[model samples]
Target: MSWKGFSLDSATSERRRPGASRVTAVKILIAGGFGAGKTTLVGAISEIPPLTTEAIMTAAGVGVDDTGGVPGKSTTTVAMDFGRITIAEDLILYLFGTPGQNRFWFMWDELARGALGAVVIVDTRRIEDSFAALDFFEHLGLPYLAAVNCFEGAPRYDAEEVRQALAIAGHVPLALFDARSRDSVRQTLIAVAEHALRTLTAGRPRP
Candidate 1:
């Protein structure tokens, strides 16, 4: 077999399967408010079929959950969504989507554990939707990048203004992304990996 034109054969294959792509695993958390398109982004960029655990909204979950921010949003992630993408010979990113509704907030830490980093997808028209994601990353001390998802015909705001409004630090990586595009989602993962690498290498955190 061959991976990216690198053949795996002979003694190498017998021993360790050379050039068939190494098992380099990296966990990345995909988080945002309800209907921010976290699952779509993961599915768009993933090299494998995305695994999603979703549930329908209920009447009891109405007031307890923050529906004000995501009026147009209907469904929500219940357990988690999983996806994968191989960026290079060794850069394989695994995306785990967290629940967006406030009721599922208890699982935040478990979902984020051992993650390389996280991407906080933002709905600029409903910026407050992403507050939980921001708070989770900040409190957990997880290195993360913020990507503003451009909704169709939604009002726009300058990146700087959004950052300031969200109180996101200037040093934290930030950019605009479209969850539906493979290229766009891939870039977001790249940004996340790069940011996490920098933070880990700087000795801020490990594993």
Candidate 2:
């Protein structure tokens, strides 16, 4: 949220290397429900090969996860996925994708520490699945944006309706997104970060 003052610019020529930078890294968590494409979004924009701990699916996972939402996704994020992107020569956004299951919910706060904000992915086909993610963000009081993942058979709802259903302000970012597309994911990231910046700059609410 308060980054340009924190990290290097987008040009990034000053750093010369990935890990070398005068500015501190800006952390951002990408969170959502199981099969919500958290890993996909991370891979889409990562400059490096994403460090994913995905493995082959087992029969035990059947009926446990919504395979219908992720076709050909034999592997899932076990712990977390890490990637980095340079927003500007002055800022670097480091992204961490949380494990995609309710059982892993307890790890969120730890993962979110020092993070600017989050991009909560929602699968409109399974609207109920997104509640946990939204609730987590609201509870953490982090500025976030909801990105509706465009899935097959996903319900068609206007942004306003989704906002009201989620009990979020209309100004909150809720946009149609396809996680597999680099440009789409990048846009979603920008929107959430921008919201966090605005909220940070606005500071505490008035009495």
**Each model's lDDT:** 0.78, 0.75
**Please, what are the lDDT tens digits per residue for candidate 2 over residues 84-127?**
88665556678999887765677787887777778988877666
Compute the lDDT of residue 190 as modeled in candidate 1: 85
Candidate 1 C-alpha lDDT tens digits along 156-205: 88889889878999889889878898888888888887787678657774
- Misplaced by over 4 Å in model 1 are 1-18
Pairs clashing in candidate 1? Answer: none
* Winning candidate number (TM-score): 1
Cα RMSD for candidates in order: 6.0, 4.8
Residue 21 in candidate 1, Cα distance off native in Å: 6.0
